[model samples]
Structures are given as C-alpha cells and as structure tokens.
Target: MPETPEIPDIPAQIPALREDPETEGTQDAAGTVSGEDGDRGTAEPEAEHGDAGFDLGEPGFDHSAPVVAESLVPESVRQVAARATLPFQAARADLSFGTAFWYNDLIETGGDHEVIRQYLVTATSRTLFEIGQWTLRGDLTDPEQPVDELVMGGFAKRWKVLEGLGVAVMPTVELHLHAERKGWRWDTQEITDGLAAQADDIAAIGAEPMPAYILGHEADDSGRSAHPDRTQRLLAGEVCRPAPDAPLTWSDPLPTGFDGAPVFAALPLPDEQLKLLCLGVALPGEGGPDAPATVVAFADLRPAIHALAPHRRRHWWQRG
Candidate 1:
C-alpha cells in the first residue's frame, strides 16, 4: 500500500528504431551500414540481403511461401536459433517464432529469463494485491460486485499464481498420500461435511459453491497421539469439540463414516460470511523450532476478510 502510485503508461510499441528507409532509418557520418566505406547499397552485396528487410524483419515464416529447407527458414529464425544456442538466459526475447506472446510483448528484446521471471512474479503479485485491496474497499468500478465476492476472486487469482509455479491442487489426494506416508489416514466424511456447510454459507452470500476439505496428518510413530487413538475418530457423526477459545463453539455427538481416522471439519462462520472453523480434534500441521505439535486453535475468517463489508467504499476511486 505504501508504494501505491499513479499507474505508469505502458508503451504498445517496441523502442527499437525502425530499419525502413521510408520510416525513420537514419544516415550517419558518411551514410554507411556500420559507418565503414563503399557504396552503401553494394558495400557487401550479400549484406544487402540483411539491410533490405525491416529492422525487426518479418513476423515468422509464411507457410504459403515456397520452401527449400535453406529458404524454408527465415533469417530471423536463423539469428534467433544462433542466439538461443548461447544459453537460455541469453536467448532473444523477440524471436517472433515460438516466443510466448506476453513475454515477447511485455519483456524487452534480449531480456534475461531469470530477470523476466522475477519481473513476472513481482508484476503478478502486485496486480493481484491491488485487486484484492480495491475489492476489499468496494471501490471497484462495478459497485454491484460486492466486496465479499473478492475473496473468491482473490482465491482464483492466487490459484493462477500457484499454477504458474507448477503447484497442483491436490487437497484430498495430498492429504491421503501424506497420511499414508506418515502412517496415518484421513477422516474424509468429517472433513467433507464441514466444507459442505461452509459452501452453503458462501452460496448464501451470492458466491459460487467452494467445497473445502481438510488436508492434514494422521498419527504416526513419531508420537503415539500422531495416530488415531481409536478407529471411531475416523468415522462421521463422532463427537466434535472446539479449542477452548474458538468462536462459534459446538459439539457433534454423532458423526459420519469411519471410526479410527483423526479429523478436522470446515464449518461456516455466521452472517453469511462463510469460513472454516476447526470442529474436530485434528489440527493443521505447523512448522516449529523442535518437532511441531498438533494443537487446536480457533479458526476465524482473515481480519481482512471480515473488514470487507463496511470498508469497501474507501476503495471507490470516485464517489457518486
């Protein structure tokens, strides 16, 4: 928020000077290609082939053009191929062929990929954060698009960032695999019902249904409690308790399905502001100085989320 400044205008055109003589091509210090000598047109007859085209050259090869393997490839392609052979970072950003359109347009020609990656990550993060901040402020262009809706929107944008980093969404599968690997099992029914309840609340807020699931650990040899104390813990309709300080406290004497699985459920928050509250004994994995312990804590909506309803008008760029 401190860095909020006027958005800079992005130039649609490349900065490089045009090679077309009819355009902006300039004659310098005696009118030669490299400023050497000779008839500029025939200084080196073969070099004319190079200077005869646009500085950036044509956009990729036209398949309709006649092809001899030698002629099949355009001069730009040959130059790009030579450059790509240097190293990935040294590759040209404006190869025209096989280049990512956004990368080609947004990134400068011959830009380093490592730099480009960092640029992309930063740009995308800033863009999403601004959108989130604006959405929370309810200053968005469309006032009818409620502030609460931004949570789902933010989630979607964040998911795109995760995907770009090659992260897969494996809520259920990840929990099962991790539990099995750590010698534990997931209480799916308990988790699913909790999420289903949250989904209903979110739907009531005019948000699309977002079914949630608990991705957590099972008991293991690391500690006796790491595993289920009894098979009944894995089943549904079992007693559900809350951490002493948690809000919206409730207990379910009966649960659904399995008996031995340690579980947690996603429960809805009040006032149509749906969120996951811890319902069962199992808690999320925590990183710690020593071995992390699974301790129950109250689950509440993020403070930013709760701040949505009343403060949205602050983000409105212009007031009616």
Candidate 2:
C-alpha cells in the first residue's frame, strides 16, 4: 500500500485553552470549537474524559447547573442538526475531532418553533480546539498557520471550515485569544458577504485528499475495514441528513464525545444543500451532550464569532 501523504502531524502543543499574555485589552472571549455525538436523540456518556480544566459557557448563566443543549434544540429540527453535524478526527489513532452544526428550526416544524438561526457554532472544548487547529495546517491559503499572525490576522486560518460550510456572520471580529471559555450573543441580522461553499471546498484546501461529506461517515458497506483502493478517510457515523437543527445521532444513541460538536444547516441554500453551521452541541457551562443535551445557538455566540469573522475573510482586518 502507498504511504498516506496527507497524514496530519500529531499536534505538537496543547492549545492554550487558558489565556495568553499578548491577548490583553481583547475582552471578547471567543470560546471557539468541540462537541459529542447524536442520533437525533439523546446523548450518552462515553469513556470519561475531562475538558482539560475548562469552564462552562455564558456569563451569569449559572455555571452550577449544566445546560442541556438538546433542550434548546426543539425535536422538530433534530434530524437537520444530525445531518449537518460531523466529527473531525484523524484517519488513524485519533478518536474524534468534535462535531459542528449548521441549520435552523424551520425545516421540520414548519417555522413553528421560536428559534430561527442562520449562523454557525462549534463546541468550545480542548480536543475540538486542537481539531480546528489541525485544519489550520491544512489551509490552502497559508498552511504554515503562523500562530502569531493567526491571532493577529483576525483568526482567518481558524474560520476556513465554517466559511466553507456556508455559514453567515457579521463583519465584526470577536477576539477570544484570551477568552477562557465563554460566548456572546447578538441580535444584528447584517449578513457578512458569505464565503458559502461545500465541504468539498474544505477538503480541496487540505494537505492531502479529504472529503467534506454532507452527512455521516464514509462506509464501505461491505463490512470491511479499508477500501479496496486503500485510500479514503472515514468518519464514525451513518450516511444521511437529519431534520433542521436536529441532533447528530447514531445506532442506539448520540455519544458524549460529540458534546462540543458544531451544528450546521442547509436551509439557507435549499437547492445546493450546503452544510452550514448554526449552533454547537454543548457549551462549557451548558452541560454535557447527554439525555438532556445543552446546545448553544449560533446567535448566542455571534458576538464572539462576529469579532472572529474577519478571519473568515482576509487577514490584517479589524478586531472589532
């Protein structure tokens, strides 16, 4: 078998989930990315894993209680959330990268539910943070991922996936370089000139061949481990789209590993069927991805993401 050329390097350093020094005056704490699993149902605990000493989400939201994100997501749109959600993991050794969602609550309930979203949100956990950073190394524009410039360049390298997944955002840049683990909400509807595209775009910019699938993990279906060609990365889920804002579930139930996954939706581009992210599985203080999962709406964290939006565009941008 030929050697895999695009194998991602083992993450050299554990990201500073903690605050950095240069991140002064940047009060905007953007708790970027992570998540567990879902099957449009409840989430169960996997092997016990800590969040690397991180706190739950939101300010004055009562950290003492765990927020069940699943509650925020109405049953009407559980399928949509499941379909757009995907785990970011290495092809080998690695377990999971995390999950992300991109959709709204209209597809299933006929706009009956109260929450209406058109933004993207990722689980703000440590592993998910590393997974996101790995994507940075795969960026087509600047694979080098200048960590220093990454922070200064409006976090552009950090948002390529969200941008590719066809999510909308404000033209504001939320700086959470020092943000420990909290999110901000916004009511503004001014859509940023979107960089809407397919997961293919995300794969295209990778160091090697990658597939940004619409839903579920790649399956040979032949009940085999490796494909005959001996090439193709695979995720850990079935193939199918879920209802808008639904949970990403599997056989039996949704795994807790996806607690911080980002949720996406394709309602915005019905004809094209793009996987745009809307919210996350679980925020820091929100609780775990369990029976009563706590999902953070994209709009909830819009302020932080908006501040980081410039990174979705070009570097040398504003840090508003």
Candidate 3:
C-alpha cells in the first residue's frame, strides 16, 4: 500500500457557538455542534480517534458559529472569504468564514437528502455565520404535526474525507475573487459572464486526481463511505448531465426563500449539465425584506439537488 498523507490535527479547544445575526426566529441559542454519537445517529464515536476533534455522529454540528477574530478559523476559509465580494454585512468583520448545510425540515421531506452531508466554505465573517445540518427522525407521514429533531453535524467529522475526495476549495475562492474584481452583482448576466470567464480554470481543477484513502466500499464504514471510487469521481468535479430525455427546467433566481436575492447561481458544465452554487448570506439584524444582505455560506450543490428549484428541494432548516 502507498503511504497516506498525514491528516491535519484538530484544535482541542473547540470554539464556543456564538450568536449569529441571521439566526433570528430560529433555534440559534440551542443550536450547537456537539460530539455525541447517539444524537447524530452514528454507531460509534469517531471524534475520540482524533480525526480533527469533530464527532461525526451528531447531526447538529454548528458550522456557522462566530469565531473570535483571534481564534483559529481555517486559513483556507479565511482566504476564500476575504477574496469574495459580499453584498451584505459580514457576521464577524475581523476574521470569519461562512458555512452552509441543508435545512432539517427540507431534508426529511425533500428529495436528495444526502446532498446535505457536504460542506460549503463561503466568505468569512461574523455578520452571518451560524450554520447547521437539519435532522428529523420521527414520522414523515404527518406534515401538520411538528417533528422534534436536530439539524447539524455531518461535515465536522468528515472534513478529512471531503478533502480526500478532491473537492477543490481554491477554485471557489478564485471564482469569488474574479467576480469581486469585476464588480459583478449577483445577477444572471453577471453570473453567467463570470462563470464563462472561469470555465477553463474550473475544468482544470475538476480534472485533478482524487486521493487514495477515499477508495473503499462499505456503508457502515462511516456516513456513506461505501463506493469510494464513485464518491471520488463525483466529488472530483465530474460533471453529471441531465438525462437526454429529462425535461429541462429553468427559473430566474430560483425560489430558495432568499427573498429574490441572487443567493444561488450555476455554471453550465462542459457536458451541458449545470454546476449549482449556493451562497448563504447573512442579513444584518432580524432580516426582513429591507435588511442588507451579506454572504456567509458558499457551497456547490450535489447533482441531484442542483437540478431542482430550492422550493422544490428539502433543506435542513427553514428560515423564519
């Protein structure tokens, strides 16, 4: 077997969850990223092994908590956030990074629920940084009754696996950089132009080789760890086009409950499929229609979720 790359060490002092401005009306105070296995539906406690100090078992791993300006947020996250031109106030202006996860309500009732497991690194700041994965374990047949659930934690434990899967973080950074420099507002024309300009670089990054550790086939291996090769290919930026017979659907500013804000955008892959991108923006105060927007979360949508409208899809949490 080939030598494996050393996994990075996670900080023992996990940051405390901070109050995010965007979490108004939601369960922000109770929302936290914990290391408990039973709460997260995991069979074992993976955080004890020291793989970045994250307990992969819990679903409510708060990715959006504000990090102190002096705290150690990932350099990659900071760099990407700094380069991107955000349209709203940042949650933490000092040193911050954004996070995105599927809303819990949508995940339980929405199609392509697995898409929520992925992590997204948007621009950094404290303006709007409370992120979590939504979870619901109760009966799905009753839509009228409120279901008790947790919505955070999948990415915290699997950060290493994501890195190994060849998800290029830098390309996203570069895209933000390019867009900011060009003064491109989050409009269709501007987004299309920016994507066209960066097509070459995106393709180059997508073609890179995936790491070997991600090549195993086992379900209990850890949150969808089975079929490593397939996962590798999918995460390696391989474009998945809609079936030729599949009807094409298009919507301007897809209704993602972002109040017509251009929070989500997509680029046409070389294969004619769309590469969906979602931006989690942090609003200044209890965000209303007039609240100024700031981007906190950034992520690429999984192929299945990317093809559908935001309203049609299920997310981990719903905005109040």
Of the candidates shown, which would achieve the greatest TM-score relative to the real structure? 2
Error of 3 at 316 (Å): 38
Could you give candidate 2's per-residue lDDT for residues 161-239 as a string of tens digits?
3332223221111222222222211211111112122233222232221112222222232434321121112222221
TM-score of 1: 0.18
The local distance difference test score of model 3 is 0.22
In model 3, the runs with Cα more than 4 Å from the true position are: 1-43, 47-263, 285-289, 299-320
What's the candidate order when arranged by decreasing lDDT? 2, 3, 1
- Segments in model 2 whose C-alpha atoms lie over 4 Å from true places: 1-83, 90-94, 102-120, 126-257, 261-291, 310-320
- lDDT (C-alpha, whole model) for all candidates: 0.20, 0.26, 0.22
Pick the lDDT winner.
2
Write down the lDDT that model 1 would get: 0.20
CA lDDT, candidate 2, residue 78: 38
Order the candidate numbers by TM-score, best to worst.
2, 3, 1
Model 1, 94-160: lDDT tens per residue?
A: 2110000011111112321100000011112122221121111122112222222111122113212
Error of 1 at 252 (Å): 13
What TM-score does prediction 3 earn?
0.21
